[model samples]
Target: VRLRHALEVRSPTFDTQQFYDLAEKYGCAIVYAEDDEAPEWPKIDLETADFRYARLMSSKPDEPTGMTSAELDAIAKQTQAWAKRGDVFAYFIAGAKVRNPAAAQALIAKLA
Candidate 1:
């Protein structure tokens, strides 16, 4: 079986070109995530891996779907842009437990 690995850099110190270089050298994909507790990417670029992976973690605690239309739109745009370059796997998991499915569907609709 082939080996596939992903790196989720949670600290700003690791969000550097050198980190990406190491990831690329090891054929590891960098995980792009949106979370209140995690450091976001300094820049959204797709030069580190052949594929893309993202964890959509930015959602207000009170928002039913955890995300608003504007947020979904922004994510859609980014996902589309990344898709043009290669495959993108995004998960909407950082929101209300009951709303994640609906949020994901809404985001899918936006992407569609």
Candidate 2:
């Protein structure tokens, strides 16, 4: 956790098992395909990455943050580096860590 914090990463991604474990423990949402339909590697463009991010964000608006190519590349590098560490978690909390129930209700509405 500290390592990710130091690197300014909120999410800690791990293998499938560890990912689920972390999500369960943290009461965060889990996003995955049981059939191992993982996203392809060496993402061709932000659109591709956006698709994955949209899945994580509940497939609402897959907006690209307009980060520079270098900045996005850095993020990809870091994500890959974290993956190399192996045995991590992909727990996600609210973007702002807000405790309001409204966010949950909003998501429920979206999914419904």
Candidate 3:
């Protein structure tokens, strides 16, 4: 089955190198770094999102799971902070929506 909760990284070019391996299994990817112009990501929106537990996709729990609650919270806070600081578009473009509608909307709201 095609998974909807996609993976997104904070610094696509920089952080991607660290998490791309972890993210490759997902349906999509996004990257928003500190200095990038527009974040690179495929098209996705709330209507297309579906949240799935990271453990379901993991063969090993010790490995990095992109959808962990902590990760989501951190990314949300960062996106929120960026938005409040007036870099809203940067946060949305940088964030990829693989399946988490709530988180995706949070990021998108910041963009708006």
Candidate 4:
């Protein structure tokens, strides 16, 4: 399982380490997400789990592929690192939803 959009995880009183420990124990992974609305959310390290789940929510409507080529490349690079360890699941789920397919294709091209 993958947990997403749980803002409480970022709360000061939240026991992050314990949460991770529990997640690991149950074979669950936290979604590593990027959101314009929640920029303060901490980034989840790729090493936290055996598999990765990333939600790319910073796509732009003006960009041809929902995101700039450079952004796609950067994501591909990071994905490569994650793939080296285990399975990688990435989704372009927000911002310019119409261009999500193109963004996904561009990322696949980069990964290729």
Candidate 5:
């Protein structure tokens, strides 16, 4: 299961290391979420878990593929690295929902 805003809210007082340890103990992967509004959200590294989960929430309506080429390239690189470690699950969950499909296709091509 992925923790969204809850993680952000609790980060101030919560023991981050303990949280990660618990997740690892339970065979759960904390999500790495990217959002323009919540740029300060903690970025969990791929090495922290056996599997990876990422949410790409910065897709823009003005961009043809929901994201800029540079953004796609960066995501592709990160995903590739995560794939080397284990399974990777990424989703374009917010912003310009209509362009999510295009963003996904673009990312796939970059990964290819």
Candidate 6:
């Protein structure tokens, strides 16, 4: 039996080689989160696994979609880079519960 696991970390304290080594040992994908609550790890140049995972939990308070065109473009480029080597699973989760789908769609368009 084979099960794939992805870890969503939310603190800067987890940003260490030890944590990455642990994830690699377990064959887990380290999630790159883009929420104010989670420290921005993807902003740094780090790759623990060929496959990548990302969860965008919130947009700016003023932006209902939680992302602007520029933001989505940048994320698309990042995801494209990951996709070049392997697979990338990205989600736009609007913590406010209103624009998640739209944000995701916009990102998808950018990726397309």
Q: After superposition, how far is residue 67 of candidate 1 from its true place, in Å?
A: 0.9
lDDT of prediction 6: 0.75
Candidate 1, superposed: residue stretches over 4 Å from native: 39-45
Span of ten consecutive residues with least summed lDDT in model 6: 37-46
lDDT of each residue in 20-88, candidate 4, tens digit only: 776677666677877776777766663556778888888888888998898899999999998998888
Name the candidate, 1 or 4, with the larger TM-score value: 1
Residues 31-70 of candidate 1: C-alpha lDDT, one tens digit per residue: 8877765545543454477778888777666776678898
Q: For candidate 6, give the lDDT of residue 36.
A: 66
Instruction: State every prediction's TM-score relative to the real structure.
Output: 0.83, 0.23, 0.28, 0.81, 0.82, 0.81
What lDDT tens digits, residue by residue, belong to model 3 across residues 1-112?
Answer: 6534444433334343344445544433433333122335222221112231111111122323324455556655655554443323322222333433444554344445
Relative to the unseen true structure, what is the C-alpha lDDT of residue 48 in candidate 2, on a scale of 0 to 100? 11
Model 2, residue 14: displacement in angstroms? 23
Off by over 4 Å in 2: 1-65, 87-112
Candidate 1 similarity to native, TM-score: 0.83
Give the alpha carbon lDDT tens digit for every residue of 1-112 in model 2.
2322111113334434654455445544333221112243122111111112211211112223322335335444544544453422322232323422333343333333
Rate residue 2 of model 4 by lDDT. Answer: 59
Q: Per-prediction count of colliding residue pairs?
A: 0, 1, 6, 0, 0, 1
The residue ranges of model 3 lying beyond 4 angstroms of the native Cα positions read 1-66, 90-112
Model 6 lDDT tens row, 27-52: 78888777666545443335677678
Which pairs, if any, clash in model 3? 4-98, 4-99, 5-98, 5-99, 6-98, 6-99
Pull out the clashing pairs in model 6.
59-66
Candidate 5 lDDT trough over 10 residues, lowest sum = 4-13
TM-score of 5: 0.82
Root-mean-square deviation (CA) per prediction: 2.3, 15.4, 14.3, 3.7, 4.0, 2.6
